[model samples]
Target: MQREPLVLESAAGPHTIINSKEVVNFASANYLGFIGHEQLLNSCTSALEKYGVGSCGPRGFYGTIDVHLDCEARIAKFLGTPDSILYSYGLSTMFSAIPCFSKKGDIIVVDEGVHWGIQNGLYLSRSTVVYFKHNDMESLQNTLEKITSENKRIKKVRRYIVAEAVYQNSGQIAPLDEIIKLKEKYRFRVLLDESNSFGVLGSSGRGLTEYCGVPVEKVDLITASMGHALATEGGFCTGSARFIDHQRLSSSGYVFSASLPPYLASAAITAIDVLEKNPDLISKLKENIAKLWTGLSDIQGLSIASTPESPIVYLRLETSTGSVKDDLKLLEDIADHALKEDSVFVVVSKRSTLDKCRLPIGIRLFVSAAHSESDLLKACESLKRAAKIVLVNHI
Candidate 1:
């Protein structure tokens, strides 16, 4: 049987109206709580009044507006990269970017727990793609050694290591420092997806590279979605001037799709401005994470899967039902009860069977800087109660 999806009547933030009822939202990816920000709203409104609603043509044709270019330049400056390219949609960035650099006969060694976007990119690349155990340096080294041995007997091919800075599927931070070391040893270029890490990690919110103390030059390519922390639509890729220029010409999504709305582009620029002016937001976010972690740590039958520093918190069942589908159903039940009984909303992440992710299914609770102490406490209490009720017999 099919069920209708819940309809949200308001903007997604720490609290939202779902099915005409207010609930503390834990499912939104608005990490820094930029949604409904007054300055951002005003910036977007100004752009809308000036530029109308949409850019009807692709970037190469007639859609290259000043706001689009401004947003790209602002992102490049913020990330300390030479240049950047913007895409109209977030998922399109990964699928288009991977194929732009790596084609057939190239090699891509990726983490097993990467999200569907990165997985789709690998599929489109048509490259020799291999998956290492998620976040395991030893497993990555073993895979690298095997691939190196195999490539020794063949003609030279370009090699890339693709991973997410903060994994969407597992909520785990990739060890960028160690990954960079391994990349140097294996002569592999790094393509990092900072979708979740862009505005949530790092002291200044530059991303995992900054958080890990890795130089920006060490990363070959970096891609991220503005939808999360920036609280805006579209995505961006930053790298050397040559690499970004190549994408502008060759990336299918960038060259063919309509450019991002001028207002959203303007909002992105304003979002970066907000980050620059208020570093305290990032610290407040860290404090919220610590508070939420402490609240949820002692829950029964559920264990925390993410780290202390990660804003994305995952709660996994202590034991599975021996069936992936059934295990996910239990998690779904917990989410439902949490919302119904406690007015707390959360999400259970379940991958499509067609996908090849190796991470275990779990409930994903996104913590934002906007969430008050009461919101975090309520979610934890609700989840603990729901989990106990749902997993009572199994536990």
Candidate 2:
């Protein structure tokens, strides 16, 4: 199928122009409303004028700058990790970070639904990959036991466990603490992708490791797209000093690719500063999530995901036989009606073969601290309209 061009122009927080009409944006990754913050913009602009565009070369060359050190230091301290490394894209961190520890024949037990980055990276590593039921500890343990009992040749191969802190499409959280408890018995390294939880989870604003009371050392690696909650460009991996030091020389993703530029790094540094200064931001963010969750709870035909301590929400649509479909007829029907009539924009899954797509009725909504009570009320109103549109039209 051929596609038509869809233009987007942002006017205000989480709202944008679609084909020239301004509509509320429900599909953005900007969780904390930092994209357009005056201070952040000012910071980035100043750095841009000072540093110019782009890093100009990979960090291995002359591109490494004071701003890079500034941001990484602040992030390391903020997340309670000793060091952090930046990447041009969040997905790059996934490939470079996870493969740093593993080699051929190593066993990796990954959550069935981790974002494709880790899956693809692990595949490239040629490590033996095992899929455990999503967030199911028993299943994961079974797999770990099987790998652990193997011969000495296989025993030399290490095991790593990977999962998201808050699943994006489902708005659910992983059982991080439960998974961590099993690490000791299984001797498996744990990796967390905190794209949705960092800057939002802990009472102190650390990521999932902090939120779960797990020390920073417990996690072998922490990688995420700062583009999400951190509201910065690129991705980062945080861990012990030696781990990052090793990656500096070994991780090709960082060594070959351009380093994060001074301007964006400066902005991220400022964003963390803002988060640290305003602990109330996290408190208010949770309240926003609670309000939305409470509003959506009583709806019929809605199967809510496990409430991870994050602010994303998903509404799974039912099929005639209650299954998945990427055609997303039901999703299109709901979104078209909601946009034209109620002005809501929710995401529908596009990948079909992976079974990630739900019944055409599935939709993803991103809640933000930028939203107000009245804004949430409008969102709920849009959902109610959406419910009627998908159900009544029966598309």
Q: Assess every candidate by TM-score.
A: 0.98, 0.93
Q: Deviation in angstroms for 308 in model 1? A: 1.3
Report, for every candidate in turn, its global Cα lDDT versus the true structure: 0.92, 0.77
Clashing pairs in 2: 331-360
Please provide, for model 2 over 282-355, each residue's C-alpha lDDT reduced to its tens digit, 9 standing for 90 to 100.
88888888887777765554555647356777776543435444335666666677777866666654453534
Candidate 2: segments with Cα more than 4 A from true spot: 1-6, 151-153, 306-308, 318-323, 352-361
209-234: candidate 1 lDDT, tens digit per residue: 99999999899999999999999999
Clashing pairs in 1: none
Worst 10 residues of 2 by lDDT: 352-361
lDDT for model 1 comes to 0.92
- Tell me the alpha-carbon RMSD of every candidate: 1.1, 2.4
Candidate with top lDDT is 1
Tell how far residue 211 is off in model 2, in angstroms.
Answer: 1.6
